[model samples]
Target: MVFLKVAPMKGVMRFGKKGKLSLRFVGPFEILEKIGDLAYQVALPPALSGVHNVFHVSMLRKYILNISHILNYESLDLREDLTYEESPIKILEKPDKELKKKKITLVKVLGRSHAVKVAIWEHEDEMRAK
Candidate 1:
């Protein structure tokens, strides 16, 4: 099985709703056909109909079968537009740094899961304003 890695900026700009910016991947879609050595044609859902299904090999990743990686399907409230919201549940760290003459703070945010790998570092000002 294979899945696609959602480009951070693209995901946020295209599929993110206001106050939500945490969906890192979109699908485990089936591969319809192979396109040469570096591309593939995939079966995308209706919500993603506007986008082309043919993706570069670099954009796809092998899906590892793991019970823990399986999300509760019923809990996901996916919209017809393929957009969803996910807010950080906790702030794990605040690191201050002096860049040039200005002070900047980096915030480590924890998502719904406690897994440390899922924590995302964001600018303190941006995180606070949101």
Candidate 2:
């Protein structure tokens, strides 16, 4: 297995927006065979079927086998909208923001909204309405 480097060349478009993008190596593709002196054919996913598979030896990196590479995917029980309902378990804190005209109250609500439950700040009036 190896990682193929992604770079910009003549007549090539970049993967990211304007500025220094962090797009680097793409994959841990299996090497099919050595094409010539310095090129090896790589097995790319269907998403990259339109791209060229052969890469230079300098653009390839040997991948060390790591247990962390294995993915443990857990299916989420989603609703029709693809979002699950999350109820606020507790109000962690209440803070007042002094605006020019009036003070706005915010409540720190703890909820299991995501896989990892996080605390979110919400308006006090909105929280009461819900």
Pairs of residues clashing in candidate 2 = none
Tell me the tens digit of each residue's lDDT in model 2 across 3-100.
88887465545555333554567778999999989999999999889989898999999998898777665456889988876778899999999999
Report every candidate's CA lDDT.
Answer: 0.77, 0.83
TM-score winner among the candidates? 2
Error of 1 at 83 (Å): 27
Residue runs of model 2 more than 4 Å from their true location after superposition: 9-22, 30-41, 49-54, 61-77, 80-83, 89-92
Evaluated against the true structure, the overall lDDT of model 2 is: 0.83
**Candidate 1 lDDT tens digits, 56-118:** 988898777788776553355668997665668899999898889999999999865322236
- The per-residue C-alpha lDDT of model 2 at residue 44 equals 95
Q: What's the TM-score of every candidate structure?
A: 0.44, 0.55
The candidate that achieves the highest lDDT relative to the unseen native structure: 2
State the displacement of the C-alpha of residue 48, model 2, in Å, after optimal TM-score superposition.
3.4
Candidate 1, pairs of clashing residues:
none
